[model samples]
Target: MSGKAGTETMFRFTCPACEMSPIVDAVIRADMLANGCYLCGTQVSESAFREVCEE
Candidate 1:
């Protein structure tokens, strides 16, 4: 994780709340730790979103 308070990377994944719909604006650490949804500002599932990152 970036040590700074306001640093992030853009992650695209499926929305877990909306029936796995593809989402294109999640933010995790550069190391793939869970952050928040850049679209809706929700930090729901970091690990699940991280799994889809390799795609």
Candidate 2:
């Protein structure tokens, strides 16, 4: 998927609680990534994994 220049494509994952999708701020440089939920601290998308490791 293509996004606006300078702004990276953000993927929203379902939140464990409330089930509301949230966009991740972490940049996705790799094909696969994973991260925890920013709101409920639940496991998020794999794309965020790279960001979590970078931090």
Clashing residue pairs for model 2: 33-46, 33-47, 33-49, 34-46, 34-48, 34-49
In model 2, the worst 10-residue window by lDDT is 46-55
TM-score of each: 0.31, 0.39
Best by TM-score: 2
Residues 1-55 of candidate 1 have per-residue lDDT tens digits of 5466643444556555444445344333332235544445455565545433332
Q: What is the C-alpha RMSD of each candidate to the true structure, in Å?
A: 8.7, 9.2
lDDT of 1 at 33: 33
For residue 53, model 1's alpha carbon misses the true position, in angstroms, by 9.1
Model 1 weakest 10-residue run by lDDT: 24-33
Clash totals for all candidate models: 0, 6
Local error of candidate 1 at 42, Å?
A: 0.8
**What do the candidate models score in CA lDDT, each in turn?**
0.45, 0.46
